[model samples]
Target: MIGQISEASPEAPYLAANLYLDPAVISALLIEMSDMREPPLDTGFRISKADPELLDVWRRLIGLLDRPDEVPVMAHHFEHELMFRLLQGPQGALLRQIAGTDSRLSNVRRAMRWIREHFAEHLSIEVMATIAGMSVSVFHRHFKAVTSLAPLQYQKHVRLTEARRRLVSEHDAAATVGFSVGYESASQFSREYKRLFGASPRRDADMVQTIVDPGP
Candidate 1:
């Protein structure tokens, strides 16, 4: 996103709205929204304005934040209304497939969940492809298309993120953190951790600890 912006261009304001929906609720809402059994596929990010009605619904939702007492009473109504507005919008067809059991998007989402759950263990791309119900070549293409990273690369990123998060809570033992995060070689872990974090694990941990737990 930063790379897409011009370095010399003036900064512009943007509103980022994040919708958090429960998986069960999402499945129920999405499946019911579709007229057929299978939900349609949707691509990744695109820029667009919100529907005028959705924009109004969104404003109503945001308005609740200021009325703390009304939130418990009215949050669900606003939320469902917002969802209703989105379902009638331009991306409605794409959003409907989110609940499909056998769509490519569903398959890739399952594969991603598997990776997050078993990030500490060694995994095979072939096995991952099987989990997604796609052949190796096909899975590779779709996985890259969806995540912009190959399966192994995705695993590497997940492992590193876990390692970094755990390091903040654990003592400053880089090798121990490395082994805990599934790295076979301590030296290789340090090298890769350094490559990703721009500093050795021990150094990065100490720097973070210093900032987060600064002395009086």
Candidate 2:
């Protein structure tokens, strides 16, 4: 059974509606939501009022979800189309900037790509700016505009994500994973990781394992 919506507030009429969302569909939606340019609204819904195009997309998405067998592939296509439509909206200026040549957005995206590819290595904004063919100030502005985070923050996120992956797959010591992800000191890594993820690495890894393989 689908979950209930709490209230009949004017803010969200659809809140009471029964919407059957597949796990894969929910995951794809979450991923796309995270990468969207717009800041989140009050409620979980995408926009204040649903656009016809977006509703159509959602309908198709729900249709795909109804067929459990085809969900994986259909979810991918739905997410792609949803993202494409979102990028066509006003907030998608960041995407357009990145696509256009000689734009600061393009340079920031280049720097971001480089950082993502080499996240395990030590990184400096100066070096990244050079790679992007821009000055430090210009790179910082555009990068923040596109991602709502500074370069260092972005690097830290990449490192934390990689560390979490390594912790789960390799079952290495938290410190070891930290060092592998470019931290020189394990203590510093632990502190930062805890701050970002709200738990110590060991606890987080154990939680992940439990979620992945819940015993009957």
Q: List the candidates' TM-scores in order.
A: 0.73, 0.63
Q: How does model 1 score by TM-score? A: 0.73
* Candidate 2 structure quality by residue, lDDT tens digits, 63-100: 86569898877877876676566555643443334334
Candidate 1 runs further than 4 Å off:
1-18, 22-59, 62-73, 88-94, 210-216
Error of 2 at 192 (Å): 1.2
lDDT of 1 by residue, 52-145 (tens): 7888888888887789899988988887777666666765654555545666877887999999899889999999999999999988887887
Model 1, position 119, has a per-residue lDDT of: 89
- Reference-based lDDT, each prediction: 0.76, 0.71
Which candidate leads in lDDT?
Answer: 1
Model 2: weakest 10-residue lDDT segment is 38-47
Alpha-carbon deviation at 161 in model 1, angstroms:
0.4
Instruction: Give per-model CA RMSD.
Output: 5.7, 10.3
